[model samples]
Target: MSLRKKIADSEAVLNWVARRIAGYARRVYRNTKWQRVGFEELDRLADAGEPVVVVLWHQRLVMSPFLYPLDKGRICTITSAARAGSMVGRVQHLLGMDTIAMSSHKRHVALSREVLAMTKQGVSIGIAADGPRGPERVLSTVPLIWARTTGKRVFCMTYSVKHGREASSWDRMLLPRVWGNEGVFLCKEWPHQVPRKATEEQTEELRLSLEVAMNDLTAEADRMVGRAPWEPRAK
Candidate 1:
């Protein structure tokens, strides 16, 4: 094979191996305790037969799969173009989810359309708001835009782990130890119909509201895990 082909092949092999390891670690060492608090709030919306956009922090993806039902309708989770995201997509698929690869810079328009398509087809949309890269816990406008365009409500999902492993990466990636306490926080449905001609203040207000909703749900999860409001790591 050519040198470039050889490199690509090797990288794919490495990714497969890494995903296997992560999968094993999750099965053998990770403890996932899923608690449903106010899940009815989310369920009521889903039961309404309306499209919804789900948002969470990038680093908390580890615990997200547990927040959702294993048999829930397919969700379109946003992922990175990186190999790690490819591995994550494989894992998510194994967990019975559908995913879409996206890049903050290059795939914006394409991903936006993909999300819209999913919504129109009655699939739920999932986003790691502080994802693909991040300024941690900060909100991104992509999901907001998708919600506004599709007339979908934005629902914030937050998770906390009582026992888990942490990576030093941005978003402080987490790996819950087996039987670790996991809590899911859901916010009431919120309108995302900001007009294309919305005022600067109106846009900022919407962004601020999203941030607060995320922080609120995150805080509640931490409380469920008995952590102080100031704790940094997932444990």
Candidate 2:
């Protein structure tokens, strides 16, 4: 009943707050002037009618929905089966995204199968590489596995703003101003490949390399928005 409790976004009631969260996201997205990078390639790829894996750090999740070309195809993201994930699903739904709400009871293979099926059905999969929790900004190899299996190249995108409030959370999530200056959304195609037969050691190395690449890409976006880069915490 306290003001502090009421003001916080609690996982227990996050689903209930989806509308307000989505509304605020839209206001910030539309009100800010965003310099977009690498979308022309995305536009072309979308027009080609095949799906690709879109990956971003969980901290930059705020404006991702708008980056999807809704008219060209459908895209979906996975969320935990926990109540917090349910809240994310609600917000994604409100923002015109399809969500695969993962069940805690399901086996890892089962979830991977479901994701593969979605890709086969022309659904683009979006992943927060360090999501559902974090070793913050660490790239998960599972998405790379899907990219290998489904033959979808990965595109990384992230954003930063000149006017925003950075959360005190582990990933330092930035909540951009609803109205103000500028921001930048930068995207790039990851040129690395995850070979189907790659050994565990190779995959692990690739993941670490990817973590650095994505962190640099994020830094570029932050710099574009006139801010210093946030260093990677996950090694």
Candidate 3:
């Protein structure tokens, strides 16, 4: 067999194993004792068939599959075009979530169209606001852009675990311990409606507001778990 083909096969096997492990993790997370706050508010929106662009910090991405309201409807998230993004997307798929494969630096228009269409179909869009690559908790304009284009409310959610490890990565990604006490905080939907023709200044204002809301929720979650507020590693 050729060296390239052998390498490809090895990678395929590794990805398969990773997916299976992640699937088990998802099951464990689902069965974890998670204490939720403000879920009713989010449920009310779901019950009313109102689509939302769910935003959270990149650090919280690890708990996404279990944290989101998957029972309400389909949830879609954007994944980058890189190899790691592909692997992450596969894991997300294994957890019954859909992924849009695109990068922040390319094919944004296509990404926007897909997100808008999904929201229109009542699929809640999930975004690690500082993801695909990030300056940690800094918010990306993608969610705001989607909200403005689709006129959907953007909701922020965050969580922390009493027993977990923090990765030595850019986002200090949280790895929830099995059977850990997870504290989830879902903020109320953003009150303002983003106009389709929102100006740059208006969009910046909204983005900053979202960044604060997400950080606040993160802090609240950590406090509930008796942990200090999570700080992203300095780049």
lDDT of 3 by residue, 1-235 (tens): 9987676557677588657768656755775677777777677777777777788887877667766677876778877767667766778878888988886566767777778788878888878898877988888887887777777777888778777888787788787776645555445566677778889899889888888888888888888888877665555
Cα deviation at 228, candidate 1, in Å, is 3.6
Clashes of each: 7, 0, 0
Q: After superposition on all CA atoms, how large is the RMSD of candidate 1?
A: 4.1
Backbone clashes in candidate 1 total 7
| Candidate 2 lDDT, 17-125, residue by residue in tens | 8888999999988799988887788778777777888888888888878777777888889887776677778888889999987786888788888888888778888
Candidate closer to the true structure by TM-score (higher is better), 1 or 2: 2
Query: How does residue 50 of candidate 1 score in lDDT?
Result: 56
By TM-score, highest first, what's the ranking? Answer: 2, 3, 1
User: What TM-scores do the predictions have?
Assistant: 0.80, 0.89, 0.86
Model 1: how far residue 129 lies from native, Å? 0.7
Task: Give Cα distance to truth, residue 24, candidate 3, Å.
Answer: 5.1
lDDT of 1 at 199: 82
By lDDT, the best candidate is: 2
Segments of candidate 2 deviating more than 4 angstroms: 1-14, 232-235
Q: Cα RMSD (Å) per model?
A: 4.1, 3.5, 2.9
- Higher-scoring candidate on TM-score, 2 or 3: 2
Please state the error at residue 197 of candidate 2 in Å.
Answer: 1.5
